[model samples]
Target: MTKKILGVFVIAFFMAAFVLFAEDAPLAPSPDAKGDNFLLAADFRNAFAEYRKLLLENVNSPLSEYYFAKCVSVMGSSGGAINPEQLLDIEKINPKNAILAANLLRLKTGSFLKQGRVADAERVADEMGFVKDWLIIGPFDNATKAGYKKVFPPETEFHTDKTYEGKNGKNTWRQLSVRPPFGTIYFSNLFRADSYVAAYAAVFIRAEKEQPVAFRTCSSGPLKIWLNDRLIAGIEAYRECDFDQDCTAGRLKPGWNKLLVKICQKDGEWEAALRITAPDGGRVEGIVLQNNIDIIKKEILPAYIPDDSDTQIDADSGAVGYFSKLIENNPDDHFALAGLAFMYDFKKILDENDKTVSNNARKALEKNPGNDFYRYLAGTCDEDRNKRLEALLQLSGKNPPSAMALFKLSELYSSTGGGNSGRRRAVSANEAEDITKTFSVPMPFREEEFLNAALKQNPDFVQASLALVGIYNRRGTPWSLEAEKISKRLLTLAPENPVIVRLTYDDDLHTTAENAGHYAKLLAVDYTDGNARNYCIYYLKQAGRKDEVLKEYRAFLQLNPFASSIYQRMADYYEGCDEYEESIACLNKALETNPEDIAAFEELGNYYLILKDIPKAQENWEKALAVKPNLPDITEHLEALKPKEKKFWEGIAANPVVYAAEALADTEVPLHASAVNCLKNEIIKINPNGTSSTFSQQVVKVFDEKASMNINTYP
Candidate 1:
């Protein structure tokens, strides 16, 4: 009884402190003093209303904005559309609300997608960037909180290490990529299961301007956050994973700031998602989120050239120069040599810039004969095709082969004109360009074999899985089932990986509206990637979401207005919906965008025929045919629509519908016949639901008005 009273007293004291704190500044309690209670009671409306009232009371409060955004977001997600402007308002009030920013941005994107405002959603996604990568270290036991408490006596010790590896005496770290929406990590992935784990994740954000940034985080277990070594917020007990469950506001210095997280998990699922946002709960513009220590260090380096260098050197050159200086001091510096070789490899034209690359790679390999990276570098620098292959083959033969080496080997084996003895090379340029047929010779080395070897060496390696999935999706010998299984496994392992999602989408194994939306969301975790656009658009169409399809089509065109094909696609979609005017307009725009778009001309020809403009139809079809003399469908279409003689009509009379269609095409004489004949022809072209047919209503209205028309005579 005494202990219970003491606990009550402690809670009361904290509540008092919270009230006092609110009066002093804008901090609010989490479990949210009132909002969480209302939400728990299933009174979402009241919860949302209460949060809104709090926001109105304190416009600048991160606490109020956070709760309000959450309430609105929940309500919006449940069939109600959220206002993007309201979400943006939260950002304006507390830009450092990273969790809220990411959540609200997601909510806003979904709303935009549902409302057919995909462009707005895409724009907001670009603006509200998620902290996609983190230097993750852990799986240290959290038994009785022992592991969590002792992992780092003070978390700052982890940050204090200046090494680019970001490793300290306390723990070994791996750079983990966690994209937004669903990117997560499992304790079992790195350590034994059914055990407690303490994980540390940290990322560096370089802000362009000084502002208060919010770090909103969600995790499966208890976690604490520190900004630039200053302890800011912490949850000491276990909890279920929830989005934006905890957030801490901090002032980000104009330049670089470090955000560190310590998560304590007790068995079961383990994961976390975090983001940094502007004071108003929007993206902190000009912020670069980085996990790679080398990248973080390089980003923070002074932009000005060293006084010794005569000319200005960009960051890349500066990096190269720094390594060059290191090499000048010690010619046998393997690290410097490896760095130079990697830089050259990144340039993608290693053969063109071979001066120091080959020498440096050779020196690095000689110095570290056992290092796979050194071997890989040497292999990249080796100009001899046979020698390069030999080095790569040797690298792959290591105890645990590098994924890069395996990937390179796969590429060499897969390429038709390379080391792979694939069939039929081009006798001429025209022959090479013609893809009408293909011949193949069996490859000496199967790409799939090496990719499978890479996967066996490191099952968690995503690139290997992706490569194998690609092989499974190869044109003639597509192994769709294997691809689907691998893709699903990849998603399970790395939920937020856009590359995996791209492959999954490419295979079209699980194409649905929801999956497409998720795929698009995953893509948004990175900067706007055009690679997934077609898949996203295709999935939406397959799911019968015409509104979303059109919205995305418009959005894509906004970004790439010169894409004539997109305009043609838009026209096709509009025509499918029986929006003839809109279809015609799209075709005209396609022509305007590119006069030589043969497909657009063909589509316009079809549109003109539907409108009964025989001359215009013929003109457009002729133009299409002129562009490409052998347009298969165009010639057939033109021939089919040509006016036929009585004998031809008789020949096709068994198909009366075809005869009626031909008769209807003769617009020279109006058919003042009973409604049945016209209705018969009209029914073939109209959708009962009125969505797919523009003339459904007009046809019905005409039928109603013609109620008095002759029942048995043609006028």
Candidate 2:
């Protein structure tokens, strides 16, 4: 009994000590000692819960509130709800805790920016003194190891000297007048150049004091940087340039500072843009810079436009004048004819394009009658069955005929109730789209046998496998297992190639969320494919899992920031869910990505109209008109909402005679005039008072507007 009492006293003493320690201990900065690893791991819900608990324990603790706000920001990054009350509370508690307040504001600013609230974001950013302008230089030749050192010279004077040009093609500094959130610029814009042009950019900045500033830059190629004449940060290889891709903190001096960037380009695009701010990504007032020279040039060499000839093609007809001249000079100019044929085909001028295609095919056949490729081309271009059959016979008769020849032969055979090895089989709808040929009578040719023969010729032929997958998927036959296996193998063999994903999806391999997720994972392996990523998201959304859609798009945007269309998708998704506010925000963001996007403006106009903001809708449509005039629908919509038109509607109810006179004057939208006429006839028959006639006219107008609303369609 004495020993048990002593043991109880010992346990009570230990528990008392623990309680005292817990009471005295300060709150942890995050759930984990290091920080919120949950957020880093993308477990936002749990992280949010942990932060909530911390805030509850110490309600007024600024750090806890700041972290909690971050959790909110992360959760709401993809159009989730934001608690304005909580954010405003953080604003109220500022100056008492400067760091915490700044962080809270930055989070608020980001939220505003994401939602396309540029005015709100700029207001916050201005309060913070964010750097919005800089002077830039370069796109020099940095293709070699020796070229690299020349970009960032070892000499200190290299930065201080305005006249200094390095051993390679580095040039003097030039002024770049722009703000953050801009798209990648082409090197060809500044000066005429080939595909693989490299350059260096330098900026001279002045700050009021020595302080840490948030530094960010985007480049469409490999980039290296030196700030204050010292190496700061860099991305060593080619990447899609975007805001905050290589974002970091760097120190600015009390006076003059130099920032040098070396961007190495291989092809596609060549340019960079920079942004600087406070450590919290807020504005920094009094940051300034000036340069005498602006290297920007207005000329964009016509040769630089993708697939366009230096000589102008007929824009209206999509005809290549240069290729036409080349063929005119020499009737047997097969290459020139083929080029024109391809251009026409790309423009979808099929009738004209097909004639050129047939001409080229004929010329190629004349050049080499034994060439299976030429024979196949002739077969493909010709619509007549007899002529196509003649080309196919020639193609098949060649020694070691190509896989393409066999595939084409199979497609023709499958169109008209063909069997495996001439054994008759039933036609399926799944096979219809793949087979270009059609016939009333059954053709005794085995489509599968021809396909198998092609596979035997080249076992690793991707096209053959894709064709087979399509047939198997559509038919839902026992061959589906084989199709699945082949798809899996193709994905592995050509992991870097995007064709596998396209073929797999085309074959309906990603029918379920689980299977679609597999494809998303595959696409995630490479950073190049935004369309493939979107394709997977489409299937995932179709599977009734829309919650994951925003998350996936946010993740994709993080990697491919220049894919402005993804923002459009997010806006569409939000709009469909009846989240008009979020949709509006996304449309604003889309404008930031591509300011000239007419579709985004049109959509924004429609959203405002839905919200009953007629003036705002008109403003957006006017902006769209400024970008592209002669949009009949926009013109019609504007006519109805005009202040003059609105007055007529109100006056029609107030003074029927005056309103009817005004309505008859307007001629746009025949339907509107018809409705007005019908209303006038009713008003005349009744011989009602002015007010009653006006009321009746107004009623008809409402019905007419409602009818138009029912048929809502916008580009």
Candidate 3:
């Protein structure tokens, strides 16, 4: 309740701060204006004081009452709760009220929907011809980013017994009533991670007779719609969501017509909107929205099936639920059995490793053996990569070919090492991240062939388009020009897609300040994206605002407190500026966040060493080694500092040999234009018989102010 009140106060504050009035009004701020200021300043008591004065003076004033109610709503008081209807009635008394019509209508409709008054919501929705009710499900596992192209079960059939492997696991259709006026199905809370996600919103409308209607929908993410199991209209772009954004004319059957929509979100808001209206413009009347899948199945779905033909559908258009039902009634129905087996793509029921399931499917295939698609499903469902590859090969040979199979074939080729593999997971010391490996072109012919074929088969296939863009992007030639065109094309398909954003920019972070906005968008979608944060930091630094860089770092930390690696990097930044105290504090915090952070321990040791705190240095290095043994540099450094007869640093005081500051290595650069003069390699054999030829040199002397050196032969 407190949080809700706070949110309301926050919103009201902004609204009040910008509230405008008539030009002829007095110059000084009005009571509503003063109240708004207090709300904005977070002085709730003062804000309420202003509201009370306004309500007392302007008795029965709609604007005054609205402001008072707004303040009360956020104060956690139920005594004078907001009455949207009363407020609306008050506004009606004076046609020229201070409150905007849009704002009033929104509040009224929202309140109605929040209270489960769908009829009220529908009444409000009638103004905009928006659909008020829908059966919605998902935040499905779209981590693979196949939401747009891959056909999930909902596309084939809709049944209560059916469930999809959704984002929350095993999701079935549930009711969603939109907030009134806008009809926005706000699903901002559905996404829990920063990954590509997909959802389904369905409405089964019963028409009096066959009729034509326009389907209207909008979203801030990639969206697609289907009517009665056929693809209709879609826009796979992340644009501002608004009513009547995309429209398509769809035919409704006499019985029940299923309007299925698939929407994909990469980040930020995971939401969608849907509405159906008459072809001419007004609301489609006399249509009942079927809320129950079972009822729809009984009274509607069966009617859509052809009366002339039996239960036969094209191989590609097979419905899993219908086939399962047919097979249940007749166990020996080989065709139905095969059709059911072909639906191995569903992760809910078809477990690839289940022997019983596989045997049953194989038997069904044997009853009607040599079915290429059945074989494809068999191998495609298996965990073995070789099997899937062989299955994909079979599909690739088919007449006209399969776009999906060709796409998968290209993927296999890329992973096995040719062309640009979209992205790979690179695990850091603290977390794993999707690292886009933007490789250069000169892709293998086979990989290129498969991708081009896939695109040829289905030009709008998103995954294939992305792959081809990746390929064209790598080539430093006219192909890059082509890549730019295709990249723009792909952006239209999925503009907010992190992958698309990354590919579009392609490591050109030095363009202008405008480039930072792209990373800002990336961070908005994924706050934990270290790469985006770094780009932001880089741009901030280039702008000569070191403080802003630190602010950016803190902003990311606020979103993800367990980002220990960020703390370590912060430590490095401070240490570079010779702020030893700040560096130590950051390192300590990193250790606190991740106890076994070996890098932080090693860094703490390095800081201690520079500060001439011998014991402190020894302790931290020992701690680092304890976390993970066999760390050579830490082990050697720790032993050398352990109560030596003569300290090891006594030597560095004399010779002052500097080593790598980061990870230890024996790697060296060749001599460039050198001005510094020094050093020679000397071989010291402990054994009298060990000659220079027989012994390996443990330490070689080198010379350079930056990096270089030579050999000193003690002949």
Candidate 4:
């Protein structure tokens, strides 16, 4: 009975196993189901939808929330706008996901800022604690009334309306507002200079009942302010954003106080605005309405004038013509003549053949010998033409009258060996140092002191200014402090002079606009001045202005039409700009100018190679080699082109039968035998040299003993 039970169990197990093996088994299909095939197929909509569904259905999945946020951030709002509530929901789902939250906030804040809804944007920023950290205000409305009411109240009364005179005079009456706490005020006007004028426009702040009010006003040009007819702050020269002169007078009384602003734009455009923030850090407002009308008429009206002279100075042709006319009218005007002479000198330096107007400057001076200006002009011409000693002799007379002439003489002397060997050697050792000391000593010395005597008589001398700055720079002093002081003075005198502009802006000591202005100041000058122009172009390129670089390079080439390497440089520039065909054309032009140019051949060959024209590459390489054969690198490259052969062994057996037959064959055979016999004998002769020899056996002794030493040596 037990045996019968065991048999029955075995039969049942086999039947169950058979059924299980026949049926299909269950497997995980989730990987394929959730795969990125939809993304690969570029069906972003479907992929996004599926991802969202997965996140909702599998909230516990670690990667679900992350991917869902990524998709939402990338897709953004397709229709009206993304609902803030939905975003808030995502944030709550994964609060630790900072990047996603930050991106979403940025987009929302950017949209708000663009619409000028600063209040709403600030509210959101407050919630995110980003109010103080991330904000860029300004390009604000700068009208005078806008600044006043924003800071004070309409009921506030002024002490005097008759501060100055005119239609929009300083005596004009207006209401002022109480001051706001803890905020900065930005004031501006349209005067040629930046000085303040009491007139139609001013700031009036309403004071709190007992709170002390403080403020600051910094100007780049000139500015002034008053509180209830009381002078508070004043500045002569403008310094934008400076903290020194731009401060409030003191605390103010509460209830109806007036503030007046007298601003001017002497040289350029002007406008002003104020930023008022309460001490409690709650209230913040910018540019409010006011009653001052003349501020707009006088200080601000000139800014709007269509015929303002300052604007004309910035216009390209106008600026060029302005200098040109100055030179034309006052042919012997030292400054004007010097300016014009330098302009032409620049061109001459760039292109020696361009004598144009510059060549006549010296003649103008000769026409007016009493005009001390001609001396510098003649000296400059001589110096530019490489007559250094002659220039020094003409300018450095015993009765030197101008600091510029003396400075030029000093430069020439220092540059041209300073007289004989001993003196020259001594000067060379401390030449830069001596020049600095001599130039920095200021003006007014004995007749024997050439530079000082000349400069003392002519303090406004441009040459003296240039000399002072140059000398200070070469002295190797710490931080170039002396040079900076002199340069600033020079800039104030001639703000638009190219040389002064370059010196002020190009120093290692200055890396910001506050330190100086943009390098554009340099470019604004004439490019005919070779040293200044080249330096300008170099700085522009360093500043990453590639378009300007190409333009300047083109101008340089125009000035130097016959310079040989310029064509190649232009070609390189074209190639950098991805103008391959232009590069090829330039190279062709270069070859036309100089057919024997090996560099052109090499460059052209490279161009063709890039185009994959191997035959053309070979052609140029061959041409280059033909001109200068045995050129080391080219010879090796040519040799590399030769065909190579596959190596093989000569005497190895090919088949086992051949080897076995050779082992059974005889030792000796005749010279001329039947073809079959020769084959057999040749195999047998292999053993005749040595039957007992293995492949590694010493064959030299066997050959000497049996192979016959008398056999012919030559094959």
lDDT score at residue 337, model 3, on the 0-100 scale: 60
Write candidate 3's Cα lDDT for 438-543 as tens digits: 2111222456777888778656555667778767767768888887788777777655555666767855645646666666667765554667778888776666
435 in model 3: Cα distance from truth in Å? 37
Better of 1 and 2 by lDDT: 1
Per-model TM values vs. the true structure: 0.38, 0.35, 0.40, 0.31
Could you give candidate 2's per-residue lDDT for residues 1-715 as a string of tens digits?
Answer: 9999999999999999999998676433213322243332223445455655554454444334334444454344211222444444546544334334544566676656444454676677555543344444443445552344453432243432365443223355444433433224444344333245556555557678866776655566666667765666666555455334445567776766666666666666666655565654445677775443431222211111211112211111112344567778987655455445433333223322136667676774665454343455578666575678667644554455445556667777666454444334554654543333432222324667667766776665555666677677666767787787888777764544555555555435334766667666665554335666666677778886777788778865554455567788899999888898999998887676455567888888888877767688889989878756888877756754543333333444332333454445553434564455546544432232323444444444543655444323311
User: In model 3, which residue pairs have backbone atoms overlapping below 3 Å?
Assistant: 236-493, 681-711, 681-712, 702-709, 703-709
- State the local distance difference test value for candidate 3: 0.57
Clashes of 3: 5
Q: 3 or 4: which has the higher lDDT? A: 3
Question: Which ranges of candidate 1 are over 4 A from the true structure?
Answer: 1-340, 349-372, 381-383, 396-457, 466-489, 498-544, 612-662, 665-715
lDDT of 1 by residue, 492-591 (tens): 7665555666656544444486678765775465334556667778888888888878877876665545455677788888878889879989888766
Off by over 4 Å in 3: 1-376, 383-401, 413-445, 506-514, 525-530, 541-544, 551-560, 628-631, 639-715
Stretches > 4 Å off in candidate 4: 1-405, 416-449, 507-521, 524-564, 573-582, 625-715
Q: List the global CA lDDT of all models.
A: 0.57, 0.54, 0.57, 0.42
